[model samples]
Target: METNSKETLQADFDVFDISEEFGFLLEEPLTHLPDHYQVWLDLANNLIHLIESRKLRDLVDKMPVLSPDLLSDHRELRLAHLALGFISMGYVWQEGQHAPAEILPKALALPFWLVSRRLGLPPILTYADSVLANWKLKDPTGDMRIGNMDLIFSFPGGDTCRGFFIVSLLVEMAASPGIMGALEVMRAIKVSDLTGIKNGLIKVTQSLKKMKEKFKFMHNHVEPAAFHGKLRIFVSGWRDNPMLPRGVMYEGVSDEPILLSGGSAAQSSAIQCFDALLCIQHEEETGAFLTRMRDYMPPAHRQLIETLSVCPPLRDFILSCSNSDLCQAYNSCVSALVDLRNYHLNTVTKYVIIPGNHAQSVGCPFRGVGTALNTTGTGGSNLMVFLKSVRNTTQKALILERLS
Candidate 1:
């Protein structure tokens, strides 16, 4: 193996502290910061209440602009980011999308920007903050299943809001083994071990299947009405959002407005990691958007995907080997990913497009929230077109000749 590939094999699978048994999820997220930062925890814990009572803005406006320098531990910084991300999202969308706040006060924006700098994440709520580092086990010794989990911070959609974030967390957890499997495939490819490669691909396929199963729990816990009307805005970002056309001013951070995408599943690293490993090619537009979403991911997870993209070519090796079983295993991994994407398409149709059409037909009152509903995603892409294009590109990754 080349020096770089050997190093990649050792480093990419488990990003120390970043990758735990739950893949990108922190092993045990800190539910509270130290007493000094209790102001943030107090605001975050009572966020739904504050937003509902129309007092979140008043409280945030009066709170002190604490320094991120006070937080030194990695886990503490992550907790700070999580709490701040939730509070900021709530603050911006407190009046709902129609009358959204345009400028985040210095008290909230400064600490969040600094915490984001310390963590190498953007100054907004992301899948990293909301899903990856946001959950805790109800019972300390319990498995990380949805039933055993609850969110550390949440939006105002009641159980549906809790369900949305936790289910997303479980999906990431389900992908943990596959992440390890992809690394194994990389190692096996470095050694030209065909049997090893085949086994690794099998693990990846199994993990994708588990991810799809976990995704189904979305329906059981989240109602489309509550998700679209109540929970969606809190996760919506500044860029491409009709509500925040000028984007948000981060008070003391920048003179010009800063634009960012919302807390998106596209920001999750697991699927993108699989895409890198399988060498699945997307069209220019779809691929560009996926690439952009990487900016919203935790830096370490983003680095893992970057490493996987440059690793030894697994798809080419599978073709050169001319082994039907090997081809079958590789194709199974691709097929499983394709199946997961298809299920995602169906879920979006139910959760986003369907509710959007209903809202439009009935002349919904919350125009700002409903503006991008069927047309655009929380990440600001053309909803159906982007997803379909991605799914199609993943389908093209199937090695047809090798199958025969």
Candidate 2:
């Protein structure tokens, strides 16, 4: 018997108020807030310049604290968050990782906190802000290829910074179809449609393969050396960091300092969406860390993951049905996801672990948001261990096909 109606499952997805066309991405993010918030727009637009001149702090310190209520729409509020996030990161680390600012000035902190709270995000740079909502179509009518896309704001690291953020955006873009496929699989499961389930899973595997191809382009644009020392620090958050033992004080928002995880690919909702729909189970520790990363995502995206988690168990269905075709389809989806994670693991080793190890060997060790590599992720997990656990758990989801 079918356990749920298609309409009921869809109602859950609709309640989150996400766009049908763009999935979790803020479609056509506002390039500028309204004129009253011009001060913020100005700061964000010229952020790289201000940081380069060591003038970002002076200007942010003197700027007026704006009310987030002034922003009228979802897109405006998101841009406000992204703008403030970029500015805050630049402000804190302006003097380099060794001398991060102990307090975020009220001009940036108060508004950032209010905006972040309203949006159900932490007041720091996150994958949602930097990658999902941080892009624009250069030609407006063109495809979202790297050459046709551009970043709305950035820190230092020049072309490398541009490459890193844009490629991450492209990865999200590549995952859109997989998101749709997951939705279709859920709908199919509600109706107990075997053909629908198998076809949907095939779509998912194909989408993941495309995502992997797009992810590999990171090497073409961002060099590992530049990413480790120069660009990585800007997106790092306050929690579990060695440098700021007490965390960051947001001048007017709270009397006590606040702790938050830095930006990480782990925060991206795309992969989590897959994990939930496929019913891939993780061990307790790995599962908890993933759940924590969800807090760093936009509220709607987080809710989507939660909703899918409680859906009818797809893995159990494949096992009980004893259908060879369905089992193979399900296994292929898991394998593609595993392949993507494997590539990501390799990329992290090259970009963070290898570079960080060499720096330590030369008598210099990194501190702050991340340490000498293996100890932490930008999201604060024990880097390689957490990733390996996740990949292995995903591999375990494959069911043995029973021959008819």
Candidate 3:
């Protein structure tokens, strides 16, 4: 019965179909995705079963996909191969048995070369050189990059992406005898405990620092800075209730360009030294702004503003924010961002917001008001529901962007 059930589950999810266009796009010489996709899926499934069965030998056998010798021959195919390996390795580390004696050392050694190259180290550096080269070419403007040959990918969006990387890295570390000792120390502390969490984080930080130092000697050569100059940030606001608070500023530097909505004011602020502009609000004050701009602006300018104003995703995001709960706050935020991105609100720019504490957790603080607003049971928290919705949307957007 168990075998039958496993077979049924695999059959249901494993029969993936690749369209001709998708095949062409993914299998193109630069990407060669099709060549690795099926192999990855098979390996991923096998790894899942191996973890369940605690079959270390089987998992070890699967590691050859990321073997330096094999990967060195197909340098251009590194990303596709690495992505698969990292994903599979992460799965094993997260779910498999704690057997450092068998696999920890291998995992620790795997990414040394990869991470070094990503930091822009020497060409003679092991597998790291190829790993960085692959991601540097994949989508430089985007946040997706393979972290290690174990097939782990990192997205630079928010905590969720950070969490994913941490988990994957932890898994790799857990495979190392010394790193496993550090993890054992971590495992003893309760992450929910305030003091324990702090201590645990300190230990993890120290381990990372040590790892960095160990690889420092290999990185005398420096690459050009990946991010240079001022970044442009566009802020879209609702007329009546803008989500961004009054004192909020971009987190990084002072010189970044900020675009704000000017809903009611007729006078345009001087753009000379201003890094950001608040565009006029689109909701309640839309009428006044429209009238003023119509009277004062040329036809071309009006057309441009009109195009900027009609963002369906932004509108949906505002609605979700207005109705969020604890259970779904994170998800709602994810959904809102995804919606905005998918609708192409600010396609040319990348944006990140420090989600307030209210939207950070899983419950709605406004129980009475939420209930009054027709939120009941799990749905009682509008914010929570919205967050969940947003997360799903973001996941879809990421996958779509990858496929596209």
Candidate 4:
């Protein structure tokens, strides 16, 4: 009966032609998805089982390195890599451990890194660190507690807190469309197909603009007090019996911690990819301002962004070709980007600065808000100014002036 039931559970996967395009992780109501997506559903569920059982490490090392090209073509493959990374952290970060998480071998880490970026997923480490690895207790006197002239509140964080894993699911759900769109954009760029590139960038620009609009929900719709209260309940049993994250994790003595430097900086990298690809250079302090923000991203992604930044911008490459039509397209793309960044600036004000004022975690290492600048210091505008600088420099970028 046991074997039969287990077989029946996964048997559903075999008949359904599972593929990544189905958006497995983001989909709700597992039973509602067509048979074509069931393969990944099983895989995703299995990964969940592994984490919940505290057995992720047993097979995490055995997971294979998949081609990003292949993963890009198939969302299931990407989903597998994502689940594996999440599972590893669930175990390695462990319950009750405060030290650094064990090193995720470059072999295991690299595939996830590539797959995630291509899929429009931000760095997994940042997702885990901000949402999972952090914790704060509710206390009138607790440092993290938000108290004002009238109200005080707290959130789930640290050990037993499922905030990281739980909230990350939502973030991924929110971000998956953008990630897929970026992958399409990169594909268009590779062929130097101007039309495809224009469409792709437009798609992403709109999506990003939408993302900024959604930031309003963080403030206007639910707000913090009721938001945190309800969320804690949703994640209530996470530590007791292990639920959304799969299970409780224990650290292994032999595992040494690997630190990922980022909390806010990773958010910037997504935007930086546009500049790097466009070869739009920032002048002096303006450029310096953005460079400094790179520290907030995971070291691997920071390295990736730095490498891309030094490459000749797209306009420089196109100018060498002397293709006017393509140049115009490039200019349009940059304008769209500027519009997108303008939206981002407003989001920073809403999500980061406002929350920071209310005692939420923001600023500095964690760029949700400007910590030092939260008090109106010099560096806070590092992010705000960078966005403005990009917009201001648009006409000066490669061929944008002629178009303007």
Best by TM-score: 1
lDDT of 1 by residue, 60-119 (tens): 999998887878798999999999999999899998867888899999999999999988
TM-score of each: 0.95, 0.93, 0.22, 0.42
Residue-wise C-alpha lDDT for candidate 4, range 202-305, written one tens digit per residue = 55556555544443333433343322322222212121121222322222211433222223322444566566666766878767656755654444445545
lDDT of residue 316 for candidate 4: 57
Better of 1 and 4 by TM-score: 1
Lowest lDDT 10-residue stretch of candidate 3: 226-235
Give stretches of model 3 more than 4 Å off: 1-45, 56-58, 61-84, 87-103, 115-404
Where does model 2 exceed 4 Å of error?
1-21, 363-374, 401-403
Candidates ranked by lDDT: 1, 2, 4, 3
Each prediction's number of clashing residue pairs: 0, 1, 48, 18
Q: Each model's C-alpha lDDT?
A: 0.87, 0.84, 0.27, 0.42
Question: Candidate 3 or 4, higher TM-score?
Answer: 4
Candidate 3 structure quality by residue, lDDT tens digits, 327-359: 132233234334432332221111111112222
Error in Å for residue 355 of model 2: 1.3
